[model samples]
Target: MLSFNIYLYCGGNISMKMAFRPTDGWRWYFDREYDSLMLEVSSDMLFRSCYPSKMLIPDVFSEFSFSVSDAASYYQFHNCCHSLNLTESQKIQLSINGIVAANFLKPQMPKSWYFSQQSTEYTPKVADIVKVYMQEDGLEVCMMVVEVGEHASLCIIAQPTFFSMNKTFYFSEAIKVMNDRLALAQQFAQPDNSIVLDDEELELKAIS
Candidate 1:
């Protein structure tokens, strides 16, 4: 489930409106009175400021909401997944309602590709977005530790070979490698589908 907060500006005053969404989508509304913007982003999203700053903090990347103060002060935002360990043949499927920023969760290889303690059980909130994975065959599948909130992390493995392309048999090879890594993980994903956004009240509408 993704949520949005609209910013309306008139003269020198700014007002924000909270909009609930039922699904993963994006929308923006602007008029003479003010300009409104809505984005369905995930917890991994990051917010960047166009204003020049020397701070080395990178930027405040968290799951929250804020408003723009000045028209001259713009922002640059993007979606990213941190701690994602990938190979040359592997690719991350990304989609966002707003923006995202991610970094390595570990200091070294293999173990460094785990999610934080606050991202695993993360339920689909108003700002929650969706993400999918794609990988070639023969690639070893590893388990990812997702930290949902303030508590423990959920360890999960990639699903089995449901999709394949060409005669390369990439999907089969990938599954074989994954089975070698952890046979139990393969079993875990067999019954579970990809992460889903569960919001009944928010409806996805076409944006013009």
Candidate 2:
């Protein structure tokens, strides 16, 4: 199978938006270019269908790769089909981009797994994937692949590490943070209402 990576583009200070419900945050949207698949994120995430003007290919994965900035000093390099088989809910979490997904399939995943409903046949490897996050003790946060989907599909394994009981205000909070950090590039003759791109070129919309 052939795998390609495409970045979503938008202008101005780029920020990520997440779609959310009051109870649970994160909405998933499917982008046909990357795959007919959408990962999960908070509601308030922002970005338009076209914003990023540049796409950079990194050296970590044989597949396509792109770098995106985050609220803090963290950076995320997204790779596609890095692995062949990943179970449902086994999402690759990008703290920088504020997105999580399991682009592959694994038999060990549960049937009630939420991500399995729309799961594809692509699994990404951690070694090939490059993710940068802040560390006080230098403990590498093990990448977790869970069955958690838009709506808590199966029993969610709540841990103290990443999962939080507090409603993190998925997209809104992230967008606010991103906008404050990035500088808007000079505006062209384009319209004012156009959405901006995130660290990756994907449209900033996180409305599932």
Candidate 3:
């Protein structure tokens, strides 16, 4: 079945005022195209009805390949199977948009396990899945989640790294140093703005 979206353009970012909650900082939204919930900051998505969707989750483990294509078909599968729990607004939105859910599943937000809730209880098999999923998720979704210090699932706290993570440094000092380095890089990047100095002159200036 063919399905499409018709978007009416809204000018100049005018929007309805809504209550601002502390947890709303991520700006999470539903992506109809993928039949998945998406992170606004990074566009990382999780398949809701189907766990480990062939498109969203890679076929990295094996060569078998099968992927869900569009919103209509995805919705049909979700509806016929009754896999998803939809609210009143979600039902209405789905009726209108053909696929998009009204909002995120509150319990299954970024902090919670997206795919398997039952697998949360510790087992050797679950532990292996966690390690594998983190690698399979790759730089796009998994890296962003890890850098922010959030554990998406009980299974995967985070991946081990080679370097020791230092947290003792002051945030403000780090920002200041980063800004100074950025300005220095920009200075050298532009030939007109770049400062040229001889080796002896540079050494003398460094000594001074």
Name the top lDDT candidate: 2
Worst 10 residues of 1 by lDDT: 171-180
Q: Which residue ranges in model 3 land beyond 4 Å of their true spot? A: 1-24, 42-208
lDDT of 2 by residue, 1-208 (tens): 2111122333443332332221223233434445323323323332221111121112211322222311111222223212312211111223222222222222122322111122122232221221111122222112222223332211111111231222221210111111111111121121232222233322232223
User: Using Cα atoms with residue i matched to residue i, what is each candidate's TM-score against the true structure?
Assistant: 0.18, 0.21, 0.16
Off by over 4 Å in 2: 1-9, 15-26, 39-141, 145-208
Which has the better TM-score: candidate 1, or candidate 3? 1
Ranking by TM-score: 2, 1, 3
lDDT of 3: 0.21
> Per-residue lDDT of 75-149 in model 1, one digit per residue for the tens?
211112222332111112111111221111221123212121222333322111122223333333333322222
- For candidate 2, report its TM-score: 0.21
C-alpha lDDT of all candidate models, in order = 0.22, 0.23, 0.21
Instruction: Please state the error at residue 66 of candidate 1 in Å.
Output: 14
- Evaluated at residue 13, the lDDT of candidate 3 is 30
Candidate 3 lDDT, 66-172, residue by residue in tens: 22223333344234222223222222222222222211112233422212232233322111112212122221111101011123321111111111122111100
State in Å the error of residue 165, model 2.
Answer: 38
For model 1, the superposed segments whose C-alpha errors exceed 4 Å read: 1-94, 97-99, 102-195, 199-208
Q: What is the lDDT of candidate 1?
A: 0.22
